[model samples]
Target: MVTKSSSGEPSSPLSHTDVASGTTGEVVDTTTAPPAQGTAGAEVQQTPLNIAELNAPDGNAPVEINDDDDSFDGDSAIGSDVGSDTTSLTSSVLHYKYENGRTYHAFREGQYIMPNDDKEQDRLDLVHHVWRLILRGELHRAPISKTVQRVLDIGTGTGIWAMEFADEFRSTTVIANDLSPIQPTWVPPNLQFETDDAEDEWLYTQPFDYIHIRNMGASIADWPKLVTRSLENLQPGGWIEIQEHAIEMHSEDGEVPRNTVQWLSEMEGAARTFGKDMNVAKNLGGYLRDAGFEDVHVDKYKIPLGAWARDKRMKEIGRFQQAYRATGLPHII
Candidate 1:
């Protein structure tokens, strides 16, 4: 299993592990995704159902957007500038530096492969909404009791989840980790942000009681290894919930058109070029199993595009998710 290196070259074979992802063996094209979205249901979810409602809440009314590629649905646009002591990104006093008002990390150079700017923030916000919708406004699928303390938020983009969880679980100390210091400085006392790579060897003084990783989408290079790391870093009988999405949009009616499929395929290929797999969400359960996780639960949902969903709740989520994709597309491309 050869993966792309930082320099855009294919590296040596990876360890032979059972990769049980639902990739469909679809051959992806090399062409860049178009600036305009196609009408196919596969890539057809590029228009915002209600951008005015979302963008209007803030001072920015009727947001200006462009059609790019994919988003975190968000990068993990994974770039950098840095703090002098904390982020050890290439020992440049800062792991990341800003280019064109967008932050990119220096350590892995192109490791993140996205821009950390306002557009990305919008995507991140959208991704959070999508997850919250999926989780039914709750945090985790794990049957975690209130007694669980010492939480870890891996790939904690924007630290939204961590801060929320910390506020809810006051007894728990939430440690958020990511490659960039993009988290807010004014965080809850229990919540702290760390600018580091979760894919690297984890060195923590204590094991966490609960771990949450979400919307990391291709940010992590080794999925199974991260599962193992989570298992090791977690306390006995601790819970870890990994919530993400499958890149291959599914439709039971076979309505997704060929052009959209090709566009989505092309997007996946671009991510793979960065050594990350956008389709890894479906295989996370298998990875947890490979890591010897017992009582692992796998839940899959078919989130609809646009307002075509039958259920009211799903329709609302689709509306948000649709707008999110629209806001995110330009940044990913």
Candidate 2:
């Protein structure tokens, strides 16, 4: 169930009618610190991350990203492969529309609940930036080699991560799929954006060496099936990495405002009525294990809800993140 936050906003990620889910890590500020004027927010700040820092573990020198273009001439269709008779992408051009004071996806209609306008895009970029900082600039934690071939990024919002990955690894083919074709037209030739749904059957000519999923907690209806498909489509010894966090408001000291609790209770009740579980992240590991994934590992990180950190960078990051949660959650709720 979703919990109360100072913002009085929903505490879940995008919604999956079946389950629910966070930020950089696990959390709470318990030093008897007075709660912020509001409940709690899982916001992320805009972080400046570079490809050089990600490639060099020694921090030896910055590796400039090669933004050169390539010519693949392969199938650029995202969902429902083109050559395959049984697979075909919906040829509808999704437009953007405004509703209830927020922007929304007009292409696939309500296939996704989050807005795709500039406001939400900024938040998505900020969320991406914060995670780069939390993960220390690395794109992913998959145990793969430098010699990667085909790579797929599911729900590639804005295609920022995919563009960066393509820029960093010019030799690798990166296919970024999303429900809306909102990515910039100019990008590395190695990277291509396609309009597709991750929940649907994946169609591609070749198998991928690495599959990456992030911040899709509220978008998927059946995560286990997705994982099973990942396992089936991946080449031998391939690895799929999932990054997720919890949404419930937590505190080590257990000091919470009763009013906030009341607020959270009511909000959760509404979510329950809608058939969306706000506690989805708690079961991700179980889903991976149930899908027959070997050596599945889950890492936990506790992120502060606001600018309550003692660390200089974390504190700055926390402030931006707080703004992100405030601005972004409304689009989803």
Candidate 3:
């Protein structure tokens, strides 16, 4: 199938196995691309949640958040109760690896550095809550009608988003695939999970009405090829949505601690050592347009680092982000 090159010109046809076999064309140097400019940072406001109270003494008991909070539904925000059951691929995919006392997926070993153990699964669900809050409880930002036919979710960690999306759009057939077969068998009738690698060629028999990719900034080796593959696998007038974040910390006053800066720099360098980029979030829009998409729109939201927002919703978002980042930093970096 024909795909766009780094220069936005039509490139020659790519074989189905080009990306997975590492036989693709030139890689896009995102570092050389000029930095994106816009409103400097995320807007912050006040909130009513008390950080100290949430982490109070006496074994740090759980606190009950108000159900009417504008941010997210208290109990319904997380995914359905996941059972220990797995897909039919369990026999081959169950060979998990262990390192430093942590478990990781054995399928496509070493491709994705992050662990897929229970701890990591919990973190994934927590981040899913953060996403729902950020989107104001919507499944996606793409302005597609509910009657869309088919959907695809790449890098479906824990399959939380995919499960919820399938439940919301019962008429649409949804396919969620990831490196690990960790998804629960108890899912909506419309949803199905698979064990697959997105970096490889997409051999989907039919095109999808919408393709959703999230939190894949550090897992892809060739972004251009991925964009091209998504383009080729999409039906005409289909929509593809990407949700990602730049892996750098910023302050409004141009002042950051030296140690923090150094740590972030080292983390980025580590990702490069594995042939991935942690800062592809800002460049996704350009990639889509260059791949021949006519209408491309971007919405950027800045999530604060802690419970420092004046708005209650923003504070909760920041608090959740703090937990999510802390849980991921040690393993991912």
Candidate 4:
């Protein structure tokens, strides 16, 4: 039951089937406001669903399982342990009854849920580009792995980057955390995923060398508090990386699309109504600097959607940008 806007782009109608297919990307502006009190959002308004409670009498769980459906090559990198971990995490975080064969844990705040479609594969490819850029010294100018001992990946959806990092640096311990534990468990001995809320008080004993948070604009309610927590968790001289897109407004050469920009602005308004801030990117550097992160570097790049750009690199960026935007609809609006 998906609809389209006046612009004729498809919009995701809220429905059970839409949740299952994960193809619902409807851009609408809702009326919600930011949370008023500090640490109030962390209080569980409703109890989360427990998978163990839904298991059959025969000790079997009723899951709408997809097999041999490796649309994303990174799925192959995740072994059986990771599979079990995904199921376990879903059981802990999700709080919905599956009408028909659809499961809903795949969609949650601060979680990277890829559509079970070809678009997801393209998104994974785009992620690889970011990784390559970082590895080849095209993205981050600082020494990434030289003195990094403990690495923290915030909002690690697929855990691919963390897994790859652990595989690359065998000696470094990588802790990947997300709101929804969708990451695989069978990662390198150095890598592990924890089920915890980022906004909640952290209880980790060890400090990390490098902390990374990507695409978390929609989920995090307080940007300054999040940066403060990161700084508290990081060791002296350690680095924290924050990656996000310009959601409310974006353009090539700063020339934005009127309709697209309007839609994004409406979406941001909706997020504000829902007790979240949609403008995390603009405040990232300021938050970092305020938190005492030295040598802070910020870079912005135009990521086009569709094949609308003439530059070869821009076109490639568009392909990835489309996937990123497609998966991001739920969070924004």
Cα-based TM-score, every candidate: 0.70, 0.70, 0.75, 0.64
- How much lDDT does candidate 1 score? 0.57
Compared with the true structure, all predictions reach lDDT values of: 0.57, 0.55, 0.63, 0.50
lDDT of 2 by residue, 1-333 (tens): 121123223344342110111111133111000111111232322122233422322211122211241111212112211111112434444545678766566565776777776566666777677667656677776555567788889888888788888998889999998876667777899998887778888888676767887777667767778877876666655667776645554433333344444544565565455444444566766776776665555555455444444455654444455555656655545
lDDT of 2 at 219: 70
lDDT of 2 at 111: 64
> Better model by lDDT, 3 or 4?
3
- Candidate 4 or 3, higher TM-score: 3
Q: Name the top lDDT candidate.
A: 3
Residue-level lDDT of model 4, residues 290-333, one tens digit each, is 76665555544433343344444533443444455555454323
For candidate 4, the lDDT comes to 0.50
In candidate 4 the C-alpha lDDT for residue 99 amounts to 27
How does candidate 2 fare on TM-score? 0.70
Can you give the lDDT of residue 281 in candidate 1? 67
Alpha carbon deviation, residue 305, candidate 1 (Å): 2.0
Clashes of 4: 7
Candidate 4 segments exceeding 4 Å error: 1-91, 94-102, 106-142, 248-257, 327-333
Cα error, candidate 1, residue 260 (Å) = 1.5
RMSD of 1: 15.8
- Stretches > 4 Å off in candidate 1: 1-101
For residues 202-244, could you state the per-residue lDDT of candidate 1 as single tens digits? 9998877678888777787888788878877766666677766
